[model samples]
Each structure stands twice: as C-alpha cells, then as structure tokens.
Target: MPHSLLAVPPSRGGVVPALLAEGREVTGSHLRELAARLAPPMDAVAAYHFGWIDQHGDPSAGDAGKAVRPALALLSARAAGAAAEVAAPGAVAVELVHNFSLLHDDLMDGDTTRRHRPTAWTVHGPSQAILTGDALLTLAVDVLTRVPEPEIARRATARLSSATRGLIDGQAQDLSFEARVSVGVEECLAMEGRKTGDLLGCSAAIGAVLAGADEPTADRLHTFGHDLGLAFQAVDDLLGIWGAEERTGKPRWSDLRRRKKSLPVAAALERDCPAARRLADLYAEPEPPEGETEDRLAHLAELVEEAGGRSWTEDKARALYRSALGALDGVDMPFGVREEFTAFAAFVIGRDN
Candidate 1:
C-alpha cells in the first residue's frame, strides 16, 4: 500500500475508506514504475508530487490524497462483473490525469500548497511543473496502450482524450469567470461539470469498457460518476469558503481571496438581497496588490452566507448526491456493491477535506 493510506492523526483530517485505499495501492505500483522511467530530477519530482518521497529523497507517503477516481474505476469494473485487475490500467490512467490537472491547476491558480505541503510548482520551477503535468498526461494515454486488446486500448484512449478536452474547457471557463463582474450559477455548474465531472465519468466507465461491458451499462456508470463529480465540486466550493484551514489544507476564505466565482459566490451574486449587492460591489473593486482588500475576505464570506448561498449550495449538493445514487439503480450489480458505492458517495459530500 502507499504509505499515504496509513492512519494519521485525526488533526490532519481526511477520510480514505478501505476501498479507496486498495485502489491507491494498485495505482501506486504503476505510478512508481512510470516515474522510474523519467530521467534524474524528473523522477524525484514525480515521486515527491505523489508523496512517495520528500524533497531530500527520503521515503514518505503522508499526503498522496485519496484516490477517489481510481477507486471508482475499480468498483466500476466489478459492478460490470470483472476482477479488479481488469481495471488496473484505467485506474492508473485516471489517477495520473487527476494529478496532472492538480499540478497545472495549482500553477495557474497561484496556489502554493496542497495536501498540507508545499505544492510541486512552488518547490520546483513553474516550467518543471508544467513539464511534469504534460508528461503525466502523455503517460495516461501510454497506460491504455499497454492493454492487450487493440480495440479496448483505442476506445479507452478516446474516452480519456474526450475527458481531457472537457477538463481543459472547464479550466478555461473557470479562469474567465474570475475576470467577469458577475457569474451565473448555471454557468458555474456547467464549467464544473466539465472540469471535474468529465474525468470522473471516464473513470467510472473506462474500466467497464475495458471489461467488455455493454453500452447502456457503461452509460449508467458514467452518469453515476458525473453527478457525483458535481456534488464533489459543490462540497469543494463550500470548503474553499468555510472549511477550517488546518483540515482543508488551504487558507480560510481561500476562494474569496482568489476572487473565485465558485458555486456559493455565484449563487450569492444571483440573490436579490443587500448582502449580494454589497458582495458584488466588493468584487468590482480593484484587487489589491497583496489581495487581502483590507482583510475583507471574511466579510465577503459572511455576505455569501447571509445571501443564502451556503444553504443553496448545501441543498444542491444533497440533490446531486441523490441523483448520482439514482443513476446506479438501473445498473445490475450485487446489493453489497451498491451499498459500497452509496457509502463512497456519502463520503464525497461529507468529508471535511
């Protein structure tokens, strides 16, 4: 197992259920093998990014993050009546693509830390971080090419390529929204659906495709992951505004500080309340050189909550969660597998970090 799956102090809060832990272990083995092929410092940088080694090259695994994408891949194959190994290639590819996005995202967003540690882009140069992300993305396709059947490889490659395009489009939209004076909740939802939902849908369906599942079953699995991805992003937006810095591994009011028009912020902006108007005014003001705006980020957060954004976001997440679970109902799977999927979905919206 990746040392990341080991129990840590409750203070550094996160949840990695046994299912996710198993998936992480399988993905880890493949990741290590791929990283070893890179030349010199690049290998070490990749290792460090995955929490398998520290900056100085000492062994570690305290912060590799939950492998939710890979776990979905594994379960998806099983749900289609295949063994976990049938999903291994897809699982690794999904995990690599996820980390690729994270590396680039941190660089683009000016985020300095992730998983309670300095981000790869901050420690290494921005150029290296970009290179690493590019390499990982290439490797994601390479992983699929290793599958025995040529047709399976071709189909999986198409799935990943399509998802990557969605992720890119979503990221671009997210950046564009930051420049806009106002953002609609619907637009934000669409962007998030592309950014987070596309890959998750791929993760849930790719394995089934590899396992020879029929089109309808794979479609249902895709729906399950896609809706869950939206719920995941909703919870993430809540954390960006209100989560504890210690547990969430991000600054308090992180989204407000970045002027992110995330779900809550966009919903608040759509409201008719005075708080929403003031929030809009605050957003319209020039961004300070240091970005604190006289430390009004807290006020921005308060304004969002008062405008009913938080409640609206929370309710939306619950609804999305229900929709995700409902998508699984049409698929044929053992009762226990269904329950496992349910628990995992619950954990997505409920996790503290």
Candidate 2:
C-alpha cells in the first residue's frame, strides 16, 4: 500500500495549518501557565511531560502531543459563534485531564518513553508520577471552578468530573482486558468510547456550554468529538502494532509484545478464520517465543492482517470519521470555522503519533 493510504487526505486550502497555529497560540500558552502553578518538582515533571523540558531538567523543545482535545474545545467554542478565547478555561481543563491520564497511564503500562523522551514515571519515580497525575486531575477541577460565571463553572466542573470518572472506569477495563484471554470487539469499542471518546466529547460539549450554545448544538458537537475519538483510537491501535519506533516513540510491535487487546487485535481474535485461531494459540502461551521474539511478533502482525483485523479496523476508522464529520451538518458555525473543525477531525485520525 502507498504511504498516502496511511492518513486521511489533508484538508483543502490549509485549514489544518490555521487550526494548529490557533491551537498553539491560544491553548498552548494557557497550558503552560497552568503547569507553572504546580509545586517545584511536580511542576518540572509536568513541564517535562508536556515536552517543554528534558529529563535533566534543562530546557529543550520537544513535541507536545498534537493538542487535539484542546483544539477541539477551542474550535467547538468558535463553532458556536463565540471567540475561541471564551473557551480557554475549557481548553485548559481538558488538557490538564489529558496529561493526568498520560502520566498515570505511562506508569500503569510500564511505558518508558513518550513524545520521544523519558516518561515521567521513569524519570521521577512512579510515586511522584502518580502524585503529579493526581495534582493535574485536581487542577482541572480547580481551573474550571474558578471560571468567572458561577453557573458556567458549575456545569463545566460537573461535565469534566463525569468524563474523568468514565476515563478511570475505562482504564480499569483496559487493565482487566490485558489479563483476560478473550475480549469481544463490541466490548473493546465500548471501552474505547469511555476511555477515549468520553473525554473528547466532554471537551467539545464544555466549550459549547461555556459559549452558551443551545442544547441541540452542544449535543451534536459532543457526538462529533465522540466519533472522532473512536476513530483516533482505532488508528492509534494500528500504529501501536505497525508504526516505526522513531515515529511512535516506542518499541516496534509494542502492543503485540504486551499482548494488549487493542481494537485491531480484538477484531482479529473475534474472527472465525484459521489465522485467528493460530493467533489465539500464540496469545495463550505463558511467554512469548523465547528466542525469536522479534520474528514471532512480526508473524503475529501478519496473522492479525490475515485474519482481517487490519481491514476491519481501517474500515471502522473511516466509517467513524465520516460519522464525526456528519455530526457537524447543522452546527451553525462560520464557513471558515467549520473548515478548521473538519480539518482537525482529519488530523485526529491521520496523526503519526
């Protein structure tokens, strides 16, 4: 397959560039300010995680993540006919919660690197990482509760709390899935909806709420974000299996090595094909192939593809991307703002990392 097959086409007329620039100029500054409010050591860890600093506590420019959630929040606000700045608090809150999950997820998964740098848990110790994650989660609430309008603040806080709870429950499910021998594609999709979609949905909805959008508009944006999140997760699972170490900042075939029941693997396992049965037998082993781990993993990736896992996941991602775009039909936004939002949805599934 051509490399172009890997990503959704870039949005026409440079909408992605405008959205990314706005995201950095608007949301990035506020994210930094919020990180600075943490206590010294924790602040440094947060900065490092955000890619503003290196492991030795020195300044180093690194790629923070794509900033998709904050961008979604900002764009949703604009799509509701409000200035993007009106949703800054929503952006900050969602970004904080996102980093909180990253910090703890790295620890839980024993991941040593992210964004091409050492993970916080590895550099700061798991306990410190856990505390930093906790602090970030609390700060999300603090920032939202401090919004100038009491009623808006209350609503935003409630929405964020519900999303965070769903995220935690999803994480619990993910960990449990790792230990189980079988996980259905439907169950995995539902878990992904909670683990990934709920937060993105909340981010979009919170922005609309902050902008005082009508209930129907907010619900539509929420659905858009939710579908986009699922598409993003599907693509991420594909990358976890086949992405380059340099591009993904992790070991090759990391998901296979860990036996993660990600969407692709679950889809493959659910198949009635011969390759699916063989893949299941490999997974049932108490240990990975002792001497040929690399080759075994390579074969496993082939099995997943042969079992129709790859095509199923790719088709699902495309379908969800369409569903997400369709949700924007009646959003009542400016043409330019709507284009930016569409471009962002494309970027979410097309991102390399």
Candidate 3:
C-alpha cells in the first residue's frame, strides 16, 4: 500500500514544520496586527479564532493553523523576483479569508473543536462567531484595498473576491451532497477543487499580481496552487478517516460520523464492489451517523477502505502532486524558492495533520 494510504503515525519533522516555522517568524506579527485592527469585540473574537488569545481574551499561544496560505503568497512573490515584504498585504488578506472560512465552516459543520481548542462558536456563541467571520471577510478586502499600489490592490481584491465566491459555492455543494444518497466522484473532486483550490490559487496569483508579473507566469502559478490544493484536500480526506484524533484535533472517524462525502467516501460509493454495496447500505440508514458508536464508525471506515477508497484517494493525491509540480515547469523562480516549493508539495502528500 502507498504510505499515504496507510494509517501511518504523524511525522514530527518535515517540510511542513520547517515552512510553518519560517512562516510564523515572517508573518506572525503582521497577521496579529491586522487582526487587532478589528473593532473591540470582533478583535477579541478574531484573536481567539486565530489562536493568539484564550477564550477570556487573555494572551495565549496555540496551534494557529499551518500558515500555508501566507507561506504560498510570500513564496510566490519571491518567485516573481519581488521581496517577500511586497506581498505581505496579500498574505495577510489570504489569511483573513482563510480564517473567515474556518469560522463559518465550524458553525455550519457544528464542529466544537479546532486546533485542539474550543471553536469560536463554542466559546463566543454562534451569533458572535458569525459576525466575527463577517468582519474577517470585510477585513480581507480592506487589507487588499490599502495596498500602496492602486492597480495591484484592485487586481488582488478582484482575485480574492472571485475565489471567495467559489469557496461559498463549493460549501453549498458540500452541504447539498449530504442530503443525497449518491454523488459522483467527478462532482466531489470539482467541489473540493473549488472549496480548497480556489483560495490557494488566489493566494498564488495574488503575489504575482502584487509583484507585477506577466499574465502567463501568474496563470502558471495559479495552476500550480490549484493542483496542489486538490492534493492537499485529498490528504485531508484521508486523515479525516484514519488520522489520530489527538493529531487531527477531531474525533476518530469524524468524517464518517458526519456522513461527509469526502473524496475517499465518494470514491468508495462509486465503486460497484460488494464492500461498496455494503457501505451504501450503511449510509442509507435513516438516522444520521452523528449518534453512532465508535465501533459503527470504525466499520464504516473499514468498508470504505475495503471498497478501495483509501488507495484511490492516495493515488489521486500523488498524481495531483506531480501535476502541481509540472505546472511550475519553465516558470522563472529562484532556485532556492523552487526547491522549497517542491519540498512543500512532497510534504502535502505525506502530512499527517
């Protein structure tokens, strides 16, 4: 079996950790400053959501996510021969958008925990969390509009807005998929491409836009990010089924519990094998799986794997990773930056959390 298909233990050291370390060092303070610019209540809510503060609004440090979007923005800028600082606003904008999505997603998905901490909706109430998400969405546009160069700001803002719209559409599709008994594998892939890929693609392109790179170069970078984002989502779907609860900060078999039509589940459903038929029967049960016992959820996960979902998703992820790297072919990027980007791609496939 491919390593990514197995229930491998989380990696302690890898490109993700290294990039996250550099990302925190480079963009951490800037992101906090931006978050602090919100109104008083919203600032506190945003701070807590960003893992910069405790529920009581006191200073506290937590996971704060992987900072992948910001890292991509900065790296894309550097790849375009511009200083990382030139893309700081773009990075901040992407981060705000990312957090905005997270806040809304937690509310929509009824998730109680994030990054091993109580989610914003759990701590601050749903209304406050919703308003804070709204604030973050607006703040993303505000950050882009304040960029010193008007043309660049305008381009970046449009790109971000378009991606945000796609993200919303994708979320809607995801919710709708749950109500249906059957969903096509292609449809699921497209939904994920938009839900996850759109933002990453925007993150990649915004840097080039800010740096005034040519259209072809910007398009190539967008393709790179889009493909990478699909691979990232595939890995995430795998983790949703098989990752350690401690590392993922979610219950074991959380995806199965929710009946989420993630890539693997969808692929398994599409198969005509006996295991797939059995899995379908389980999903067809009238009651939602939320109240299901761990044993039942474990069986559902096994059915998915027995139906070939795990290997299918793993192969798809690896293929997308290669396609992402291929998208960078002949693009003008610094050697060190290109090497780093390549390592990041590898890390996405092998990541445990």
Candidate 4:
C-alpha cells in the first residue's frame, strides 16, 4: 500500500466530447425553458446561477463546467441498454447538483477563481454565494421531481441524498487530514472514496435504475464509477504540482503554496529524507517567501519525485483505472459504448494538466 497520491491518467480525448454532448442534449435551452416555468419567484436567481445572466438580469460571461456526473448518468443508462433520450432529465438533475457543490466548495476552499473566471463568493461575497449554492441544491431537487416517472424520481432522490452525504464526509476528512501531518495510505483511500467516489457511484446507480437495469448490473456500474472517480482525483492531484498552467488553469505548484495534503506531499512525508524534513519545515513556515515561491515549489516537486511519491501515485491510479475497466468488462453492453468509455478513461489519465 503506497502512501503517495499522484496519478498519471490514460488517453482521454474521445471521452470528454461524448460526455459533453450528452449533457448538452439533456440540459439545453429546452430544459432551461422548462426550468423557467418551474422556478416561480426566484426564477431569475436560478437562471443567474446557471450562468445565463447576471444579478441585474443582464447577460454575463458565466461558465458551464464539465458535466462529469451527468455523463455518468447517461452512460450508465446506455450500459443498461437504454437510449440517451430516456435518461436526459436524470442527467440534468445530477449535473445541477454537481454545479451546486462546486459553488459551495470554492467558497470553503477560499478559491478566488473557478471555470476560468472569478468565483461567485469572490465577486458576490460569502453570504450570497452560500445562498446561490443553496438555491441550486433546491433547484436540483425540483428538477428531479419533473423527471416524468415517480419511481425514478424517488430512487434518484435517495441516491443523490446519499451521495451528498458522502461528499460532505470526504471534504471533512480531507480537511482533517491536513491537521495531522502523518496518516496511513488506507485512510487516504477511504477519504478519496467518500469525497470524490461516492457521487460517481450515485451517478452510475441512478442511471442504471432509470434504465431498469437489474440489481447486479447496477452494482457493477457503481463499482466501475467509484474506481474511475478515484483514478480521476489521483490524476488531478498530479496536475496540481507538475502540470502546465495553460491546461490546468492555475499557476504551477499552487498546491504547495496552499499546503494541501495532496498524495505527493503525503508520500514524501511517509519516506525518511532530508527533503521530507525540508517539507516539514516549509509546512511550519508561517508564510512562504513570495520571492522564492517558484524555486521552493520546484524543490518540493523534486522531493516528491525522489521519495517515489510520483511514481507510486501514478501506479495506483493505473491500477484503479484497470479495475474500472475490468468492472466494465463483466457487464454486457454495446461494444461501441464500452469503447467510448475506455477512451474517456484514457483521456482522464493522460490529461496534460
């Protein structure tokens, strides 16, 4: 059991386009029209949060994130032998919930930027951002109710609720990990499962349920999604340190500046090295020198690689990716669909940032 967290993903080009197209079809202008009818007095607020306009009802340069959760919903449905049309609403609802989480997370993490723009809290302040996130969550529930089938909505509500709880638990555990310098790799994996994997599990389960998949089939999809989510996060951790700014949308080594307890740092800490001592000292330093930030970050990267953290994390991600593919292999789905997912997984693993 390696204690490091860096992950190098596989080739992922075809995966993103498929997922994005599915999401676009599910939650396009037509859904927006439907949402408008259901939104009532706060319709404008919901619209703004969706990146359609500003507080004053003027058009704004808002962002639409990668609809990963929604894509899972649609893909799971496909794996269960349903057309994308039948699962569209469920996909929309999951995406709305994911965006809601992002809104609140940015605030909690004190991130000033999101989706290549200023974060909601950074521009609107904490109270409004909190309100916006809450509103989005409420809308997510509302969107689920409009899904045409009572049973599907009921199951979706349960799944989404459970996923939300898992995400909250994961974040709590992640924050807690920071307070303690040393932690086991097992605990870190469990934390990743909760923080990042649960929502993915829910995405697959909900899609399978809507497609009328058998219980066993749905369970396998759940497993696949969970493993894939873990792999995705591991790769993301790698990007936080050594990735290019253009691709990642952040300065290089921003994680070091934040002292985030990423897999690389944890791995370095687990090993006995002078660089580990230097890292400990750096962690203790109240304020990292503004002038030396880049140089120090480079040194930290060297330490991470030297401690075998980078290679270890990459290997773990590869193992998890392989496990996810194995889970998919056990299922009887269209070869083309499965190929698409495989490509997507590869893209996730091989992303530049």
List the RMSD of every prediction in angstroms: 5.0, 1.9, 2.7, 3.9
Predicted candidate 4 versus true structure: per-residue lDDT over 276-349, tens digit per residue? 77777776666644554677778878887787778777887889888888887678987677876776666656
In the range 1-353, model 1's lDDT, one tens digit per residue, is 00011121121122237778888888988999998887767787788899988777889866898899999999888898898779999999999899999989999999987888888888877988888888888899999999999988888888889999999999999999888999999999999999999999999999898998887998899999999999999989998888888888887778888889999999999999899999999889887777585358878888998998888888888888889989988799865678777778887887778
Using lDDT, give the best candidate's number.
Answer: 1
C-alpha lDDT score of every prediction, in listed order: 0.86, 0.86, 0.85, 0.72
Q: Return the TM-score for candidate 2, rounded to 2 decimals.
A: 0.95
Q: After superposing candidate 4, which stretches have Cα over 4 Å from the reference? A: 1-16, 30-63, 289-292
TM-scores for the candidates: 0.93, 0.95, 0.94, 0.87
At residue 198, what lDDT does model 2 achieve? 90
Regions of model 2 farther than 4 Å from truth:
1-9, 288-292
Could you tell me which residue pairs clash in candidate 1? none
Q: Please report the candidate that would top TM-score against the real structure.
A: 2
Per-residue CA lDDT of candidate 2, range 224-299, in tens?
Answer: 9889889989988988998888889888888898889999899999999899999999988866345437888999
Q: In angstroms, what RMSD does candidate 2 have relative to the true structure? A: 1.9
Order the candidates by TM-score, highest first — what do you get? 2, 3, 1, 4
Where is the poorest 10-residue window by lDDT in model 4? Answer: 1-10
Whole-structure CA lDDT of model 3: 0.85
Error of 1 at 116 (Å): 0.5
Q: What total of clashing residue pairs does each candidate reach?
A: 0, 0, 0, 10
**Pairs of residues at least 3 apart in sequence or in different chains that clash in candidate 4:** 5-263, 9-349, 9-350, 10-346, 10-349, 10-350, 11-346, 11-347, 12-346, 12-347
lDDT of 1: 0.86
